[model samples]
Target: MSSAPGADAAPGSNPIPAPSATTPTTAIKRQTFSSLKVRNYRLFATGAVVSNTGTWMSRIAQDWLVLSLTGSSTAVGITTAMQFLPMLLFGLYGGVIADRYPKRKLLMLTQSTMGVLGLALAALTLTGQVQVWHVYAIAFLLGMVTVVDNPTRQSFVVEMVGPKDVRNAVSLNSANFQTARLVGPAVAGVLISAVGSGWAFLFNGLSFGAPLIGLMLMRPSELYEVERTPRGKGQLREGLRYVAGRPELIWPIVLVGFIGTFGFNFPIWLSAFAHSIYHAGASTYGMFNTAMAVGSVIGALLAARRATTRMRLLLGSAMIFGVLEMFAAISPSLWLFVGLLVVIGMFGITVNTTANSSVQLGTDPVMRGRVMSLFMMVFVGGTPLGGPLVGWVTDTFGPRIGFLSGGLVSAGSALVIAAVLVKAGGLRVRVDLRGRRVRFVEREPAGERERESVVAGVG
Candidate 1:
């Protein structure tokens, strides 16, 4: 027997519910930082702030080092590509490892390895032996570590704070990262201007101590119990099938893949703008990033306040993100471009947080590691393809053309995917000219309702 449309349904059973105008006042009033109340998560987040700041500092330093050494945007792209290539090739296996092991322990090992890599780079750069190739090697090794670290860290949040606060925790994680971003680049700029990239790398290498200590100090007893998957074959295949069957999971991943591969090539574009177009130096580059970080921090904080995620919100934000990128790409003045980047950062983080929370919340706990690995893979792994290509476009044509092309692809993909999702859900656009409103509403045909009911039941 099929339940009637609009009837109460188990969470995750209805993959696509129509948007509601009225959110409960209590949900609205929920504190944005509620997840920080958990001791374990608080520790983890505190450590993350220190480490993420170092991570961002390293990123800016690394990019500047490569550009200074090679003077070719293509070479910079190659460096970025080499770093993420591991994620493209070995990402699924990393997820398997994350599932079968204790995430906290795995994170400890990975973080330690990454710290060593950072220190090694620092050593080379400080000694004046740092070639572009040295940075490339280190970046690739760092990516290899990230293959394990990214998914493990992502799935670890649920254990720290439990399900009820997972979304809040995820939002706070973004906020933490963006907060670091707000600080990291500015500091890196001063350091690079006064000293060089070597000191920044050294700081990053040493910063890992914070996370290591935090992890060691966490009380294991307070963590939510989650069943770890046993060692087994075909787990990778099983994960692929799981996402392949779920529209909610699959669609977001697909959308991110498109956006990530094309739209998120900021390293290439930002550097080119600073070097070629703006005729500026490392400090100006850092300022551009800082401008974007300001918006990203705001966006993450806003996302933390929302108790729920919506597909419409994700799509809308993504479209706006693409449009803003396009405008920023062509701005005549440096400050105008910087201003556009702020709005771009806002919408960019909005898309990221919404998609992240939606996927994490909708997924089964046991499958989370694999699911998140796939998410991270697409979200970042595609950088290998995007980085070089965007770099080439920027090098061969100009930064404006390269950036504009990425925005075009991003916006075009969102529109196409939006149409596909609407059709799949048997939905129609409801426009009320008098109210100046538009939203998606269910189609009224009985057959369509029956079909949707059947699909919901199966899901």
Candidate 2:
């Protein structure tokens, strides 16, 4: 098997390897969907698709409902912020909890709680008792549950498929979610337009059963074993220190933090674009989301096909994603805008899956939960800050200017991070205009080169 960069390094002390090309084996090349060959993961993925579809449905419904009630993009942002606020506050603790408990059991509890919350929201909306505060309250509660759920679910992938297939599984998971994204928004748009958001919420509430049942059906013996961290103090501090010491792990998390915080406020942007800019209805909003999902699915599949993750890929994709968003923000026509959304979705998922797999592979299995929590905390948790800010921007300035500003931040941060990584790695950028290529090459001092030559001769 092709080794991931720094895959063999000690936890918290991994050396950041200089950029290198990867060559996959014939067998590895043929196993794009290799993770699905395992029955347990297959079952897990099957159930996830159903639940994720419901999730997207609920998300679209919730955003639309808030906008409909308040007629303000900022309110939709507040709603989105409420749903992710707990991650900002309590995300690290959730990871510790995941490490201390059986992931399957933890998942069951979190999933059930989320499902109930969905039902409760549905009841409020259907009975005509729903208010902005009710939606905000339920969203906050859901965020609380997700604190536990996100890490448990993330760390569980390695157990289901083992390290060999973790990257593939991660990519497939994205593909699965994007696939649902493709379906959920379309269905939600129709439901919201016809009956109201209530039924969409109800469908989401019922969707949790699929994953719960799948968890129950798994053969525990067939799953890979990972050592669970015992209950103790200092664990949270340890997780943080472990990550802080590892440049490979910490830098990617930082890059994702910037991208996630500013680059991914799609709910606010899309809703504003549909409602105010295009003067379109819920169906058009759903269509916009669905178009993006199509590109995301393609991106995920491409990631699944790769045998190795590279730092350059992550940086390049992030930069591209931001640039595309900037372009899409200014597109003059609806078709041109929708087309850009597709490409933006593609690079966006690429950034996500690459960062995810890179972090997971570099981390020790024992510390995986906490490391992933930090990864996720920066990735989604910052939404509490970004969502409201972007929402306000859209409300005050206009959707075009708001989106352009986010894109600028995302692209700019990526460039800065790339420079930092290059400097830290003691590497120089090599530009071969003749070959039309750019590469990172180690900077070898004359003394070091002479020493290496003498040593090679002696050997």
Candidate 3:
């Protein structure tokens, strides 16, 4: 399962420590914003914020376009499916590619390609030549590019700030993404209402420049370079074998797969709720997304404060999030639903951020790209399966049924995985009036030293 030695740090380890007293507290203790202290990361994040917002804007407009052109929620789901289906197929290969190349250069290439595609879509829509097929084709192309971009970007965070700051960087990155989620959809909705969708697409296309510039401006000498995986046959198989052997790594991914497949089917749920159940227009749809972003930003902020990722916290958040999502599904009023979305969004981010940091911290640096790809493959790639299933459920049984299914699966999967890990990790869960507690005991079959699992806060 091991790769060559002298590779970068494993994502799963807390290799980097807090700066000594000689270092300024302000530089280190900005909570989630601490990662912003890195000059490269700051520039990267600022540009990413701009680009991410535009990306969200395009997503809203694209889904809206599909709905408008076909008047079918299933068609909208197909568009979502098109974007992630490539990940299901090529994500692992992309991970291998990430390990082989410098992430910054790879990101520049991918970002430029995506921008060109966005501009093409915008041109078609503005020229009145846009159709559902065009949207589908563009989405498929974007997904193809993202197969490489997503993993490279995920693993690239380590190079920007090294492993010690990587957790903060990951949280801040999520926070940045959520911030865009807050702004993008709302603005996209208004833009769609006031003018049309073409401008939104154009904006997203142009937004890629921010990131490209950031990449170009980075001080490459300051980067924390790691050992790149040498190109060879059988390396891909070795990557898979690496993850298959680690329970700590495998469980969280399994948790993410079930959760992502069922829990993160937000596109289908939001679209169905906005268009079908509520008859809400684009503005209302944007409001739903923004409300969720509010929670997500808060969740990301909270996650940033922690130094360690815990398995218990990851599982617990999923359990609660599943329940809340179900309740949000059956909300009687739109306002109440929006409010619930805020909380659900918060819990959802906790699960996601924790899982990401945990897996990265646990894996060796050399294997970061491949393991993260596997992690994401389960987390985001599950969409190919879930998107259509949820769409079918929304179309057939109703949107509420779709929500209930996702919630049940997410909650059930977490419970099953947790139950298994209680034995595998040599832990006991005690039930009492004081609530549930998981205590680390000695590994079974022989007495051994207690392995302290560093966690942020007990769930």
Candidate 4:
């Protein structure tokens, strides 16, 4: 259970061993930072941390800017919608572009466009000439760019360190994003309080420079080469068929869709909670986000240390997220509610990072772009469609019901999926009487069904 089949091994070799808790100090010395041993991945991670921090800052600033500009919750929802709508419409096509083009060069172009877009928004907002329409226009444009940029960036990770290090790389990528989430919002809050939202936007624009430069500086020879597929009859259909044929690919996408639509609409709920439930201002909202970011950072770090790619942990964590959200929804005190959010955020990122890593690690190298795009589409594209409904629920029924609805739906979906996976795989679930640990095992038809539990662990 510790070492997943063929995970973290040289191609065609045995899997790397899971480090033992009782191993001597001398034994530990031989282990390496498998992914970072590659120079290109190190550079990419470093640059991404710098850029991702800026992205988070902009997110916080953008939300605050919209809230300040119009005190209505609906405006914030609209801003979120404009940014995610294109992903719903064009995400699959973005996969096609990633498959057919040179991802590095495509990324360079996309990054530059993003910087320009961010700077344009900053200039507009700073001069006091910005209207709601301008924010909408900018959000839509940014979404359009991300439609292509997202898949390209996702596909680019595999090439950075290759398949052997892919799981670690993906976990580290989540860590980087979460780390940025922690810094960016705190910085944005102070900047917005002092000068205006414009400087936060400007910093985001500048953040693009790091990744752009990192892409340029990569040695082409060290990168993994994904062959470009020629345009053919039914190419996109082929990608769909490819996914349809694989349960490993299809189920994770379904799980993420459910989570994204319900569990992931945090900002919508957070904004309402801060203003209505907590009776706090912009700074309080920032603190709420920062707390979530703190939890996310911890989740990402824990995921980075994982040696297995099993889906059970992810599914269970998602269940925990739903349960915690429900706890937050009914809490009477602001401190208790914020504390619940911290736990919710922790498990939320754990579920997301685990699902993402599983899907990517399970995929074929040639098909990764298409697969990941499909994954991203379901995981992110569903947001725009769901956000308005969530927003309306928050605005109408109130924040508690909105949170309750999402939490219940998420937990229900996960329970259903867990049952299906268990039945299909003929899995046995075992519980130890003395501890909180549970073990699951896959059983052959001829095997003793009651004794099939493969391993045990603390839940």
For lDDT, the strongest prediction is 2
Ranking by lDDT: 2, 1, 3, 4
Q: On a 0 to 1 TM-score scale, where does candidate 2 land against the true structure?
A: 0.91
Clashing residue pairs in candidate 4 are: none
Output the TM-score of candidate 1.
0.91
For each candidate in turn, the TM-score is: 0.91, 0.91, 0.90, 0.89
Model 2 Cα lDDT, one tens digit per residue, 261-287: 999999999999999889999999999
Stretches of candidate 1 exceeding 4 Å from the true structure: 1-29, 432-437, 445-459
Which whole-number lDDT from 0 to 100 does residue 416 have in model 2? 92
The residue-level lDDT of candidate 2 at 219 comes to 73
255-290: candidate 3 lDDT, tens digit per residue: 899998878988788988998899988888899999
- Minimum summed lDDT over a 10-residue window in model 1 is located at 450-459
Query: Model 3: runs farther than 4 Å from truth?
Result: 1-30, 431-459
Error of 3 at 337 (Å): 0.3
